[model samples]
Target: MVEGIFHVGEALAAGDVAYLVQAPETLISPFGRDLVAAAEANGTPVYPVSAAVMGAIADKDNPQGLLAVAHTRHVALNSLGPASQPWLVALVAPQDPGNVGSILRAIDAVGASGLLLLDGGVDVYHPAAIRAAMGATFHRPVVAASFAEFAGWARAGGYRVYGTSAHGRADYRAAGYTPPLILLMGSERQGLTAEQTALCDELLRLPMRGRATSLNLAMATGIFLYAIHDALDQQGYFAARAS
Candidate 1:
């Protein structure tokens, strides 16, 4: 079950919200009432309870007036073929759930095709990750696979795989990022290992111009995702849509 207005609303829009539980006072607001109407239109059950009752169902100090039950949405690796997502970001065994969610949000913000959580990472559905994503998890295609499996898929689909490193010789901006590509980011704890880096078509690094030698996993990944996007834009990659 997902909690909060944003998460529930996204799930409702995705047609997965089965039922809703709301606090009595929320009906006075427009968004709250609209959510109830949407849920009802879909034949979803809406239960109104006192604030005290809501607190019992919620994980937070404040229940935020809503909680919802939604079915899990799974995205298969094959479903994310080249056409489905021209660019993809793969996270390797991310230790922190919030970082995973933030990266997922970044992927959505930059219009990347989807996210790949490689190896055994935090559950995407974990409330912390889902909450941090601010409902982005509901619509984006998220696939979980081992590094080997993901590598094979990328190779078979003819994708250019770029791995990030602290000591990579290639600057990310100079690397010619093409579509049907994957930007592979390392784990929060250990970054990328030698074996993992070898699988990549190229290795890239961000400029450490300041005292800081590294960046937060999500922040670094977001930077790389946008860099690739801007490069594609400069190449007139988005022109076809306007035409």
Candidate 2:
């Protein structure tokens, strides 16, 4: 379910299957008009409701005039293969929905392949996550799996898993991010478990000079993703994609 004009617009632009859209009678933004037009073009029903009614259905503190109900899209873990240039972000037992959503947004920004949720933390479909993602959730595939199941799949697919840790030997910038790579992050409260870290082909750490000992999950993931993207780009990853 997508709420607010911005999110609804993103869902429509991404070609998500919308079942219905509801808007207040007072909605007059050009963006809202375009959204209504697009929904109607795709044969989706757009219902006009009272502002009070809209408030009851919308989840935001400042509810926008638009809301959309759309189908969830995800692929099974078994469906993943050893495709060329695969770059994936895997979260193990992520604790916060907002963090999950922010991470998804970052993943989209870096043009990574997709996201993998291992052993389940927050529901990917949670409204907070969906809102925080700013429609990125619609832009990429998100898969869920257990640690053991994911480990088996990664092995079979020749994926090099890179786990993050403060005590890691290799600096994040120094690590090699080859194709078919997986950036594995642990939960907020607890970092990667012993078993989880043990499975990684390489353990990486971000340098910290300040008094702060750690970064938030979303921030840390973003830093790692952009760094990996830069490193891969320098190695002709983007050039290969263009060809």
Expressed as tens digits, the lDDT of each residue in 64-183 for candidate 2 is 677888888868988777574399999999989999999999999998988999997899999999999988999888999999999999988999999999998899999988878999
TM-score of each: 0.94, 0.95
How high a TM-score does candidate 2 get? 0.95
Identify the candidate with maximal TM-score.
Answer: 2
Compared with the true structure, the alpha-carbon lDDT of candidate 2 equals 0.88
Relative to the true structure, candidate 1 reaches a TM of: 0.94
Candidate 2 residue spans exceeding 4 A from truth: none
How well is each residue in 1-243 modelled by candidate 1, as lDDT tens digits? 788787888888888877898887744667867888878887899988998888887887766788888888777888888876888899999888899889889888887888999998899888889888887888788999998899899999998999999888799989999888999998887888887898898899999989998999989998998899899888887785456
RMSD of 1: 1.5
Candidate 1 Cα deviation (angstroms), residue 111:
0.8
Which 10 residues in a row give candidate 1 its minimum summed lDDT? 24-33
Off by over 4 Å in 1: 26-28, 241-243
